[model samples]
Target: MAQIDYIYSAHSAYAYLGALRLYEICKAHDVVLRHKPVLLSPVVEAAGGLPFAQRSQAHVDYFFGREIERWAEWRDLPVISCRPTFHDNPLELPNGVIITAQEAGLDADAVSFAILQAHWRDDADIADHQTLHALMEGLGLDADALLEVALSPDVQEIHRRNTEEAMEVPVFGSPTYVLDDDPFYGQDRLDMLERALSKPFAASNWSNPPVDIKAGS
Candidate 1:
């Protein structure tokens, strides 16, 4: 069976936007989806992208603001107009919860989507233990047992490793889908991703001019 490595963060807006459709695509294609949650900041930094705070107002407004609104409408996913109150809160807790579910034979995908929806739709703080517990319990999972393991060093280590591997993949942003080692970065690429399920794209012969050598220099 074909597998797609779903590398994303629990709080990523784009990931939330693409969540359900991604599940649909996987089901339609009979592809196995591996949910690999990570700390998004480090991965974004490693990819040479600016932190949210460091980004210019224009950059943030368009990409993080307007773009999100447009995509939410496009994807038919409801999202809070403003950023979540706890958007900058630490992500280890939520990311670990997803990993814990995966490791503990729980429904990690459902857990992942629930977290994403809560954060995006309801502005829930995923970093909060109570919020996580409620989210898990809502899924009919053993909240206490899951939270205990989710916060453990063993599960957090998996989250750490996920971030490391994403950096190695050099992921450009959240919601990267890796098929046969080729990365389709961002939810916007899902259509291409679906197409590739039937017809893989040609091998990459990608190249870029040396930075020191300017165009028309």
Candidate 2:
């Protein structure tokens, strides 16, 4: 079976924006979508991207703020006008839940989408046990069983491994879809991704900047 590796953070707004469309494409093409939830900060830093706090106000206002609004409208998905209330909270629990769901052979896609929607659309605190329990229960999953395993060292180790793999894959940021080892970095590239699924793109001949050249030299 052909597979597309989905590498993204649990609380990512862009992931929420592309969640449904991505699933739809997977279903249409009969593709196996593997959800690999990751730690957003380390992945961003590894890819030479600035952390949210370190970025300039203008950049933040445009990309994280206005860009998100535009994409939400484009995707026809509801999103909070501002960042979620617990947007900065630790991701271990939420990320772990998705991992656990996958490991348990459950409906991981539904589990992941529910958490992403809750964070981006409803402003739920994903880090809180009660909130996570409610989310699991809402899906008819065993909230207690999932939460207990989600916090276990084993599940956390898997989360760590997923983050490491994302770094190794050189994933730029959230919502990267890897098909045949070619990475489509953001939700904005989903159209290209869909096309590639039917007709694989030419092999990459990617190049980097000259090491000696600085920006605007």
Candidate 3:
């Protein structure tokens, strides 16, 4: 079976938007989806993208605020009008997802969408254990056992490793699918990713261009 390194933050809107489609595609293609939930901050910074908080309102409106509307309608996903109540909260729930995938050996695909729904639709605070536990229980999973493993230092370390790997690779945004070292970033590129899966594309011949500079005239 072909493998993909699926990298994203657990609470990311884009990740939520593409999660189900990506999973279905992989299942259809006999592919393995190894979900690697990561710390999105350092990775975005390394890739020279602005944080959501720091971006201008117009940028957020178009890229994030509005894109959410367009994609939710297009993808038939439910979403609240406002941003997730705890969207900017610390990443324990994000790490919990990685831990769930690693220590519990559960499908991160299911857990990922659940958490995303909890935050994005139900307006729950994913940083809260109650919310996480409730979401896990909803899936008929052993919430206690999963949470125990998810909170362990070993699993946390695994998540840290994932974040470090993401930063080093410069995966700029959420929902990045890497197949054979070729990265397709964003939910918008998923169709392209599906195409690439069907038939690998020719490698790009483009190279980094020389920097242009000029002294004050």
Candidate 2 error regions (>4 Å): 212-217
Task: Report model 1's TM-score to 2 decimal places.
Answer: 0.95
> Residue-wise lDDT of candidate 1 within 171-216, one digit each (tens)?
9899999999999999999999999999999998999866653455
Candidate with better lDDT, 1 vs 3: 1
Provide TM-scores for the models.
Answer: 0.95, 0.96, 0.93
Q: Compared with the true structure, what per-residue lDDT tens digits does model 3 show for residues 1-217?
A: 7899989887889998998899889988999888888888888988778877799988888887889999999999999998777788888655665567655677677888888877788888888888788888888888878877776777788888988888777798997899988888998998988888899999999987654535422
Clashes of each: 0, 0, 0
State in Å the error of residue 204, model 3.
Answer: 2.0
Error of 3 at 173 (Å): 0.7
Per-residue C-alpha lDDT of model 2 across residues 106-167, encoded as one tens digit per residue: 99999999999999989999999999999999999999999999989999999999999989
Q: What TM-score number comes out for model 2?
A: 0.96
List the candidate numbers ranked by TM-score, top first. 2, 1, 3
**Candidate 2 backbone collisions, by pair:** none
After superposition, the stretches of candidate 3 with alpha carbons farther than 4 Å from their true spots are 210-217
Q: What lDDT would each prediction earn against the true structure?
A: 0.92, 0.93, 0.83
